[model samples]
Target: MVMIDMRDIQLDEDESEDQYEKLLRRAKTEDLTEISGIGCLYQCGVDRLGRPVIVFIGKWFPATKINLEKALLYVIHLMDPIVNGDYVIVYFHTLTSNNNYPSFTWLREVYNILPYKYKKHLKHFYVVHPTFWTKMMTWWFTTFMAPAIKEKVHNFPGIEYLYPDIPPQQLEIPAYITEYDMTINGIRYFEPDQSQNLLS
Candidate 1:
């Protein structure tokens, strides 16, 4: 677990600011948004198809309930202004081949409680560089999604493959994802004959 130091949190210097402002400033300073691989939504710009781009990190987020809830609320708050009744938000989700992954139950809860207006704006969902494990997890999750949402989901083998659908310039690819070396951990897929070779 990561330890947070109260002393590290910065408070606003202006005494005239209201209590809400001070509290909000503290929240921003103390939140887990800085964690690597935590789910974050940033508006990059419009894609070639004119859909607004919203980037999301899928792994490395804190698994604890309190942290997860705070992250979800933060994402929704940032996304609200960018989405409108007619706007379509293009979600670009970065998937890690190995390492951390967000909890399924937590993700389900986050999606289930989203306002219809927010959900309706999600027109496309792209999973970047899906690995064998990601494919299996995605398949399991799809069973719970509405048909409309399912239809919007697609997978890209690599960054080059995403160019045709979502212009490469609009995306803010993380350095870790860009420099991913699949060869080191590439052969982890399930093979009945080589079941013992699976990654633990």
Candidate 2:
């Protein structure tokens, strides 16, 4: 029989989650403002599917790829205590387009270099509001991913479609996503005359 460390497991799941959350709330980066753009928000609860959800905004990424990677890694490290079991990463790339999007090469490199433990528990990857170029880029880049990884990807053209899978309140849907969704549905407060203003 194999030996196991009972101390490694926390009996009180809520207490463990609370501890992880405290760390995340206290987590600081070199650039505080940038944290809003690329940092993880709340982690107290799971998604609608009962899996831990890590929410990240794609457009908030720094222009420098290295900085972006570092910020993300730092955030993940802070949440390391709770990022086990079946976790689902809900990425809001609604505002990300070719102009601001990272190079496909960098994306491919990140995927190839992801740690095994990180890859194992990733149950789902939900990409919301994918642009035309985003779709094209994903199609091309996914060619390099294994079938299992590829199956985890799910694209959302509209937030309405995403609600069934992930509740709005559960994910704490960002204002920008809600705004974008409103614009998509011909509901916008600004420039009322231009009813069809959609963010790219």
Candidate 3:
């Protein structure tokens, strides 16, 4: 039998508590006006299965202009309450230019720092209008680093595919995403009147 250092364990526990407190402070105090204005992340509503639906609009995120640390804090603030139960993420990748994408290192760091509780209750991760790069990057990351969530990740070429799992009526989808979907897929996911209204 080996001897365990109680002092070391206590120090680690204290460090974790301190870190959590710091994150809570930052989440409460950080100025996330720009991020909020762009509407990069929000809870649209609940899915058919009664899971909370968290939407992340990729095109709205200005990675270069925004402070990533504050953005991460804002994410924690928005998600902390929702993650306690089962939820699903709908990532709209429509019209996402290269500049909108965050750095791989930053993405990795955010993933690493996120508490396991956040990862545990995520039932599904839907990527709508996924590009080639998005698919490849997700494949690489999930396969190499996060194998547990690999099966939970689903890629959709258009919003129509997502409608089966999450009805269009349930989500407050951005108009631009629907327009882009129509442009590429040559089809509308919403009803005729709804599609017309979205375009109007």
Candidate 4:
């Protein structure tokens, strides 16, 4: 695993993501490929997908506010060919105690500032909501909420939903995925969204 730094992820809020990434790459060019992790740092204004190309992962879970505008700006910048395939790992900056979790307030606040195209990316999010649910909350929203959201997103134009649950081991996945995440692993293969009630 490469050792990426916190700065790599906290791109400038004013600079375009490409410029920021360009600077980052130029600065860490020799060691870019070697970095295995990074830490909390938020940037703003990105691609149409709102997916931040830069990811920050830390030993402790992320508990910091993820400047959703910044984060979504990143994601929007990453859509297109990137979203077509591959799953990027996300480590929500989890903090030590009581106050831990994405700052939804900040997220909502910054969300409006997103570029029209960036906002468009989230529009297709309905297709990936289940995975988003699994990734973000580590809980099966389908089981709790109506699978309607999942189905709705699946219907979005140009969106492809892959790995309904877990594909056979032979299938190639971008990252190592466990049937259930060890710490925050969801109840996969159990109480699937199809169950009558999530409690089952």
Alpha carbon lDDT of residue 162, candidate 3? 65
Root-mean-square deviation per candidate: 14.1, 10.7, 6.4, 14.4
Tens digits of per-residue lDDT, candidate 2, 1-200, equal 98866666444444555554554454543444455545444453576668777776776655455355555446555456555567777777777644456666666554544444456777777777787766676666666564456767778766555455555577676688788878876543233223332211
lDDT of 1 by residue, 70-134 (tens): 56556655665665643333333444323345677777765655545555777667776676676
- Tell me the TM-score of each prediction against the true structure: 0.62, 0.65, 0.83, 0.31
What local distance difference test score does each model get?
0.55, 0.60, 0.81, 0.32
For lDDT, candidate 1 versus 3, the one ahead is 3
The prediction achieving the highest lDDT against the true structure is 3
Model 4 sits at a Cα RMSD from the real structure of 14.4
Rank order by lDDT, top first? 3, 2, 1, 4
- Supply candidate 1's per-residue lDDT for 147: 46
Task: Name the regions of candidate 2 deviating beyond 4 angstroms.
Answer: 1-44, 186-200
Q: Between candidates 1 and 2, name the one with more favorable lDDT.
A: 2
Q: Write the per-residue lDDT of candidate 4 for residues 1-200, one digit (tens) a residue.
A: 99977675555333455554453344433332212222232222222233333223222223363333344333344333343433222222221233334554554443333323333322222221233333444334433432333322232111112223222232231232232132243433233243321110
Residue pairs with colliding backbones in model 3 are none
Tell me how far the alpha carbon of residue 10 in candidate 4 is from the true structure, in angstroms, after superposition.
30
For residue 94, model 2's alpha carbon misses the true position, in angstroms, by: 1.8
Which segments of model 3 are wrong by more than 4 Å? 1-18, 188-200
RMSD of 3: 6.4
